[model samples]
Target: MTDDGFMGPPWQMDWTPKAQAVRDTLPEHVRKTVDAVRAELVTAKDPYFRGVDTDADLPDGMKVRPIQSSVPKGPRIFFFGHGHGWLRHTFVRRVEDPQIVVEEVFWQ
Candidate 1:
């Protein structure tokens, strides 16, 4: 149980985890390419991050940022957690063909 008092896992767990879906959705060749992308990421000093990931072979409107917190700084990719309300149904984390930009970095 969490402080919000719900008796369940922190995440809904209704959908497959994002990275697996990306691998499953691609053709074998594409999957291999994705694997290579991942291979270059895994265990590397460079960071991997994403905001709102999806099961596809393209950018997820993600802000691929350089993590200069340490050496070999590069894009950091990690999946986004679900948005609280309607966003989950309306959004699947695919980078829109027309990119979305967030001008301000807001942290509470």
Candidate 2:
């Protein structure tokens, strides 16, 4: 936990260009939804592993093979821990120092 006493993920997370690009295209309402999800991650005690659904498909041409987990939320805007309604696919990883790096975002 930081000085704010919030219990977030074992690592901090941030948006990659991919995620940001998707966010930039969303409507204000949808963006708010994605924003809320991100805020939750910031305060979540296990953001990396929380709310992860392995059945979700990545943006790659591959189908949903139950081999990956994504953080899809709020009508599917598609973020790392974001995605509201207009975004598509995203990847995230935890760094050695306990930080989650949002790798990329993709569309179908």
Candidate 3:
């Protein structure tokens, strides 16, 4: 949440419950990948390797159909892990430079 401006829609970190019951509800791969993504996201700034798409731009009308994720008009990305039933989901698309306008789009 730096002066980097609105990096996209407001998002919250993992809200998974600490309860054992909820822990065992999702598929094994989902849980494992979630942890994997979590571990990477915890250190997204490292260049050696990276997790999650923090700096990537989201194109208009784009949808993550190949994976178990959703990208509403709010323009953000979501975890491909277990679907959070009713938990609030957020979309974020990075917008670079407030200046330099042009006629075409640049998918940086």
Question: Which lDDT values do the candidates have, in the order given?
Answer: 0.30, 0.42, 0.31
Better of 2 and 3 by lDDT: 2
Q: How close is candidate 1 to the true structure, as a TM-score?
A: 0.30
Model 3, range 1-108, lDDT digits (tens) per residue? Answer: 446654322222333243234435657755554444434333344211223653353222221221233422322233243333211222223454211111111111
The 10 consecutive residues of candidate 2 with the worst lDDT sum are 60-69
Off by over 4 Å in 1: 1-16, 48-108
Candidate 3 residues lying further than 4 Å off, grouped into runs, are 1-23, 46-76, 81-108
Strongest candidate by lDDT = 2
Query: What clash pairs does model 2 have?
Result: 11-98, 77-84, 77-85, 77-87, 78-83, 79-83
The TM-scores of all predictions, comma-separated, are: 0.30, 0.45, 0.30
Over 4 Å off in model 2, which ranges? 1-11, 50-97, 104-108
Q: Write the per-residue lDDT of candidate 2 for residues 36-68, one digit (tens) a residue.
A: 555544444533333445324333222221123
State residue 37's C-alpha deviation in candidate 2, in Å. 0.8
The model with the greater TM-score, 1 or 2, is: 2
TM-score of 2: 0.45
